[model samples]
Target chain A: MSLFVQTLSFNYTKRSNILNDVSLSVAKGDVLCLLGPNGTGKTTLLRCILGILKINQGEIHIGGRAIRSLSARELAREVAYVPQATSTVFPYQVLDMVIMGRNPHLGLISTPSSRDEEIAREALTKTGILHLENCLFSEISGGERQLVLIARALAQQANLLILDEPTANLDFGNQARVLMIINDLARQGYSIFMTSHFPNQAFLVCNKVAIMNEGRILACGSPDEIITDSCLSDLYSSSIKVVSARILDKPHKEVKVCVPMLV
Target chain B: MVVAIFFTSFLFGRYPVTPDKVMAILISKIISVPKSWTDTMETVVLQVRFPRIVAALMVGGALSVSGAAYQSVFKNPLVSPAILGVSAGAGFGAALGMILYLPWVAVQLLAFVFALLAVAISLFISKIIGGSSMIVLVLGGMVISAFFQALISIAKYIADPLDTLPAITFWLMGGLSKVSNNDVIFAILPITISIAVLYLLRWQVNVLTVGDEEAAALGVNINRIRLVVVLCATLMTAAAVSISGIIGWVGLLIPHMARMIIGPNFQLLLPVSLLMGSGYLLLVDNIGRSAGSVEIPLGILTSLIGAPFFIFLLSKAKKGWS
Candidate 1:
């Protein structure tokens, strides 16, 4: 397993648990999409896995090494994180923002060297945003900013990438673009673990799907096996239909979509 | 530009020493040049103006760097060096020292100690309340600042209006006229060391501006880095305010100006703020002394010049920050 969790449980206070006994794993070259409704502890689970939140009881291992045994820098080298995009107070250049990924590799008093700049440039190229290198990060569009964040994570040089709502605020075209990039990274043998509200997105790129609700995983399997009409409808507490639709001029190909039916 | 301002500042006091005499007197220290200037001229230049000019540069540079670092660490562009109640605490200490009839050196020492004490109190309260979140620390600082300001008011209420009250009031107005060679030497070590430490951690400050959780995910030990930055910035602010009294606006305005010149990359912003702050205060000091018969206090002049210029910069630029 590229990433593994065993019986993880967490809570902010003793009165209630936010994530209860969650366990999952992702293999190399796999794209796992965690699906859940709002306020279902999906993000809390991700935080526990990233070591931001201490677990109440459980074990997490990255590449067979216990997470508690690794230092923060070591963890960063093993896993890269792409947080949701937000505006910054200062306007940093895209290249400068990307170069910040080299922080873990630097010493206490040292800055990034020229070789680190080369690595940042390579990450930018991989994300296909090399042309936006000189633009101010604040001046870019939201979708472009998301891509820049992904580039920054890639610059960490970690094989496992964890993203939180990577496609949340993007338009349809930008969503497709980001999903395609995720697919490409998985094809390049990188393990991807991401959380999303869109179940259709799991069908688009993810090979594995995990449904979480009220701090527990309801099911975990391949997308076709777990993302059913009943599972989503019950998970969302609404009526949802799973339908197969054929594309124009592509009758041989069909895709599954989740549609909500109003009373 | 800083060098030119440093040398030119020596020529513009009540004692009119010619530019050539200024150069001759400055060079005479190194080589054996015959003294063509009067004893009073030499005293005015070397003993009086030299220490004051050096104090301006050191205090200005230190305050600006501290402000820039605080702004980054707090992730708020409006943050100044006085955000943590250091200035208010120092002001109260200075007031109490004056009312107690302490000597000038003792007063400055008390101010430095109290400044650090105030920050410690703020940090302690923050730890108890919210465990190290920036907003909680800021609120803690606000409470401490208000408390210190009240203490200063009490000290003023009991002070002798004829003697101690005016002295306390003047000191609070801020100036460098009384700074001697010893005061400059005393403050130089802490100011220089703190600024050097901050300069080395410039890149980490950039990461800090990305917010706490994000910075930690990027492998930064957020608590350790925040503590170091806050300690260094407070030390520099305390030392500067102790020597020059509460000179305001340099801390808040110079960083914005530096950011305007070059965008907010601390790699360049730190050095730029240091140099610009030095030159700005020197020029302001020149105007303060030569523009009138009696030297105006630096705090008043800085506010006078800084407020209008800040407004102009804000109105002219589309966005002061990103």
Candidate 2:
């Protein structure tokens, strides 16, 4: 249950080098929080790993097999991706939206199997939205919408779940609820990989942390090992500040504040 | 439900043939048994009218199903068959073939080919400009539509005012007059096959509702599948248009009606739209033929009735979905 990135690279437009020779490995039962400054290619890296963006150089290997060696369908069976945000241009019921995750498992023309229905229901329940199954997608709150999207990825039944900015848009309470769900899923043996700017969040939940800057991995270690005063200060040299807080028995974190150092 | 509508509609047409009379007519026509078969009743019940009625039923269903498929792929409720320049391209191709003295089959085939070519060119242009962007895909459809309409206008100007002009006018307006047994034979095969393919692959269409990248991630090949679906939808719509001439409103109106009734799954929407489309067209065609001393063109009859009903539908639709 390890996700490996080997020589992964990507391009945007005709211009090359959005991601450059970036590689990392996440072990079984690990929550790897990808911490990066803005425009550090966090979302691009996720797309390349998911096979949505074709690699210009090298390969992504999942469990010792090249990503190119597996069919898109086969690879999708191994990985589930939740994007930053999605807007349903057409208004559809929440149940219908959640059931779209059953796409890979169901036949081209066939209805969702009873097993798919059961799995989808369980995913919804895990995300704490089984009661909101009948609600219209457009009528839901943004945090609820994000949970519903997570429920969709969970329904894919992949061993590795990749999320892009899972809590980028949410209140403090909602963000914690989302992070708690991810932590619970990791405990249930699903490998969680996500990107975050909130170093505090990574310190609380992720056992392994990778900090990125300008399309390169600047540091990769455990939260306490990778984050230091100089590294955190240089990471945000322009206007740096740290606010310490202890949630008593929960978790304590040194949060970075203000604009991050880009160079 | 499509089956139920087909039989029920047959029972309730202008000349209401009783179930017993329908049986007698079927038997007499099969054996050519000599009896006092009045020519008008015989022609109405068997020869001239039956094929036209069946053709309308099939073609109307084809267009509506095509529209539903397009709406899903384009991810826009406003998309229709004509929006992709498909209808206009096929119309112009058929008109040119008819004016040049081609046979009906050749004309229909040519029309189908050009209609597909129009969509292909638009797809390619979208790829070149805004690769895989939804707004780019729709804008490409709009440009292709306007370009084909300019061609249609040119074709109308060059035709003979007396002979070709009225013929083109009638064809452009759409009707059941040109429907023959050969046309029915020709039309139903491709139409049935395309609709069957659509029904078989309808669930893949659900992926499109979420957006393309999500669809591609789910082991779905977006480009390959889009090509096949567009070809099938275009084939059904083009063949239907070649026979019925540009029947307006069925493609535009029926998907909305069906979505309202059965929800948004193509499993239900496809069949329901098929039934509602032909039934609505049949009602309009009946009025076109039987309303007065002179027969009005079917398109005019449809629009005249369709416009008011559509406006009423529009006012109600605005408050609910958007």
Candidate 3:
């Protein structure tokens, strides 16, 4: 397994536990999408697994080694995180921002050399953003910024990738583009652990889906078995439906979509 | 450009030395040139102008690099080297030294020590107040600065109006007129060390700009790196203020100019800021020395010159950063 969590529980205060016995694992080349509603501790779980938040109970292991045993640099080399895209105060060029991912690979005093730049360029090219290499990050569109962040993660050269709401601020077409990129990365043998609000996104790219509700993993299995209409309704506290249909003029390929019902 | 300005500064002073004489004096120091230079010329070049020029360059470079480092670590472009109360603390210390009739070295030492103390207090208060949010740090700095500013007022109030008050006021205005070789030597150690530390850690500083959570996710020990960068910047700010007595604008202005020219990459921004800062201040100092019969103080001249130039740069630069 590339990333593992066992019986992880977390709480900011003694009275209210933010996460309770949450357990999940992702192996090499697998796509695990954590589906939940707002305030359901989805981000908390991701933070705990990333070692940003210390869990009060249980353990997290990256590549079978206890996460606590590794320094930040070591853990960063094992897993890469792509945060939601936000505008920066400084107008860092797209290339400059991507090269920051090489932080884990370089020494304390070492800077990104030509070799590192070459790697960053390759990552940008992989994400189809090589043309925006010189553009200021602040000037880029939200979807382009999201792609830039993924390129940054690719430059980290880690085997495991963690994404938080990768499609949150993007338009529908941009959202599909991001999902396609995530799916391609998984097919290329990178393990991905992602959190998303849209359950339908799970059917598109994720093989395994976990529905979280009220700080607990209510269901965990393949999307076909776990992401039913009722499970998503319970997870989000709303009426939702799961339906299968042909997408984009492809008759043989069936796609599943989860839509929130109107009251 | 900096080299051109540096040599040109030698010709503008009161005891005018021709460009050829300046070159001869400079080349004579390195190798065997004839003893054609006068003793007064030698003293003017070697003893007076050399130390003054060196002090201006060092102070300017130190402040600019310190400001850039602080802004990156704090994740606020509006922040300057003095944001943590270092200048106010140093100003109070210098005023107290004048009131006590202390020596020049004692004044410098006290200022440097209090500058560190002010930052330590700011950080401590922020820690006590709870989270490590940027707002808390900035607020803590404001409180500490106000505290030190009040202390400076007290020192000025009680000081002898005849001698100590004017001296304190003059020092507070900031100038390099009294900068001796000893002062330059003392400030160089801390300033150079801080600048080197910032330069070596410049790339890591970039990681810090993405904010705390992202920085930690990238495997940076945010607290440790912040402490180191803050300490190094504080040391440089303290050293620069101790020698030159709170010359403003170079720290805040040069980094922006550098960023406008080189973009936001600190590895390049830092070196560029250092060079631009030194050259800008050296040119300003030359103007201060020769502009009128009575020499203008550096503190007044930097903003008088820096503000308009910065505005011009802002107008010409692209609209990217908000």
Best by TM-score: 1
Q: How far out, in Å, is residue A206 in model 3?
A: 0.8
- The full ranking of all candidates by DockQ, starting with the best, is 3, 1, 2
> Cα deviation in Å at residue B96, candidate 2?
1.0
Candidate 1 chain A has its poorest 10 consecutive residues by lDDT at A45-54
Note the chain A TM-score of all models in turn.
Answer: 0.98, 0.89, 0.97
Return the candidate ranking by TM-score, descending: 1, 3, 2
Q: Chain B, candidate 2: TM?
A: 0.87
Instruction: Give model 3's TM-score versus the native structure.
Output: 0.97
* Per-model CA lDDT versus the true structure: 0.91, 0.79, 0.90
TM-score, predicted candidate 1 vs. hidden true structure: 0.98
In model 2, residue pairs whose N, Cα or C atoms come closer than 3 Å (at least 3 residues apart or on different chains), thus clashing, are A235-A261, A236-A261
Candidate 1: clashing pairs of residues: none
Clashes of each: 0, 2, 0
Per-prediction TM-score, please? 0.98, 0.91, 0.97
Per-residue lDDT of candidate 1, residues B1-322 (tens digit): 9999999999888878999999999899999898898998889988999999999999999999999999888988899999999999999999988989999999999999999999999999999989877789999999999999999999989999999998888888888989999999999999999989988988888887887877877888789988999999999889989999999999999999888878888889899999999999989989999999898999999999999998898777744353
lDDT for each residue of candidate 2 in B92-158, tens digit (9 for 90 to 100): 8877876786887777777777787887878888889987776776788789878888877887788
**Model 3 C-alpha lDDT per residue in residues A1-263, reported as the tens digit of each score:** 99888998999889989999989889998999998888999999888877888889998988889999989899899999999999887889999999999999988888999999999999999999999999999999999999999999999999999999999989999999999999999999999999998888888899999888889998888999998878877777789999888866878999888878898
